[model samples]
Target: MSNGTDMALISELVARERLFRARHNPEIRDCYYADATVATSWQQGPLSTFIGAESKEVDPRFVIVGSVSTPVVHLNGDKAYVELPTTTHMRMMVNGTLAELESYRRLIYRVERRDTKWKISRLTSINESDNLRPVIVGQDLHVIPQDFNGLRSSYQFLAYVRQAAGGQISQDLLGTDRPEEVERLYKETNAWLRAGV
Candidate 1:
């Protein structure tokens, strides 16, 4: 291929990768090469049911199936971290009706950049909830931290300190003698966290 053609292909692959990371519902089979294979050892299903199924047929249609939120994606040049919420649904073949099933799964997708395309060769999926910590305690602290912050001293301090570090906390963490550069410090800290440092 000519240099311009190769560049165009690379750009297309990058765009597809971005769209996939953004939770766009592209048919994987259509985008992936014919020889591509999604490992079945990590898949959840009857092992023999769809061994030869096309990638498009088996690929996800929805990023978040129910009340669950879409997972966050962190991407760099040739690597990405995708945290996705998997769904469980029961679809009746005879009636063609679908019902939400009582099941949940979490997945971390590791993407690799190949010569002309980006492929997901490794997927770690789990059905348990051990890793997830409650965003809020009994009283919706995530929604209203001020009302609950004062109830307990130690936890309040920790909470506010963390929030302030992220610039989400109130102004009292540093006291009346707070530094003038508090906000800038907090912003720097946030950037550091994003850099995975």
Candidate 2:
């Protein structure tokens, strides 16, 4: 396909991703390649983990309120690379007060033409910044403690844990002395993470 066509297809796919994030619609998965992979700056593991992290029910208050710039695309035959820079402002009600987080992210998508259709084969995201200031919005305004610093977000931490478990499984499969123990730990860790989420 021509470069313009490739760019258009990739741009559409990125827009679809944003829509999917806001809506949490499972049908959006159709836009991805069957064996697509994803890696993010703040998170590790496969794309499925990221998808699972999204809430099943969309919260009306927690909505994306911002605009995204046009993506820069590079086309190479059947493959296209796209870089999309976006700044998103999310607002939600927390403890009866309005809370907001402004996040800047650059998303890279690798789209490929498969069977006459374009599909995203891989996606990578770089989190530029996530600024969350404490300011109560009510009859009385108070500052809340910012205790979430120096700690990975829940999604990033969980992804690292899952990656570690996978590594342990691989090592155990390589004829480790304590295969049974490693297997047990892997299963337990997986179960614990799943339950916590």
Candidate 3:
């Protein structure tokens, strides 16, 4: 398939993910292959568990804000491998208070062409950082963040790469030219994760 075709399929997948998060619609699973496997940083086992969390009855207001960056797609016959950067902000109300959490993830989706449609067969989420706090209205309360040492390793690797490039890394490579900004982001992410929300 052409790159354009691959990207279109990825775009559809992203849109489906946003729809699922916004509406907690179980029918959204139709976007995935029947035996799709999903691995995320926060949970183990089936992707159903993650999707089911949204279906649980709750009174507190829940919101999910997400974005998917341009994906690198490689098409091989009937299969395609897509890698993209994603950011998500999840907010919920608890005991009349509001809490928000942010996470950065590198998502890899294995897409396969079934007949004339493309379906996601496998998804692997590489958690870059978790526990980012979003500005929330009213009282400030959050969940205890989980410790992910990979954040430190990622930071160190970026720093090394920047140094190797004579202290000048392209924004395209680092996502931002400022190394301090990356450190600050990771710090905030770690704090949010430690908050456990």
Q: After TM-score superposition, what is the CA distance of residue 115 in candidate 1 from its true location, in Å?
A: 3.0
Work out the TM-score per prediction: 0.34, 0.60, 0.58
User: For residues 1-197, what per-residue lDDT tens digits would candidate 3 score against the true structure?
Assistant: 67687678766775676568567677778878768776554344465755655323222255667887877776665666667788866664432445455657677677777787888877766546545333464454432333222224323333222233245322222223345754564464334324422
Least accurate 10 contiguous residues by lDDT in model 1 = 91-100
Let me know the TM-score candidate 1 reaches against the reference structure: 0.34
Per-residue lDDT over 1-197 for candidate 2, one digit per residue giving the tens place of the 0 to 100 score: 56776678778888888778667678667878768777653334556655655423223445667567898876666666677887766664433455565667666677777778888777765555556533454432133334333333422222222232242112111112335643564464334324422
Q: Number of clashes in model 3?
A: 13
- Give the poorly placed runs of model 3, Cα more than 4 Å off: 1-3, 52-61, 92-97, 134-197
Candidate 1 root-mean-square deviation in Å: 16.1
Best by TM-score: 2
Candidate 1 per-residue lDDT over residues 81-115, each given as its tens digit: 45555543322111122222233444444544567
Task: Spell out the clash pairs found in candidate 1.
Answer: 163-169
The 10-residue segment of model 2 with minimum total lDDT is: 167-176
Give the clash total for candidate 1.
1
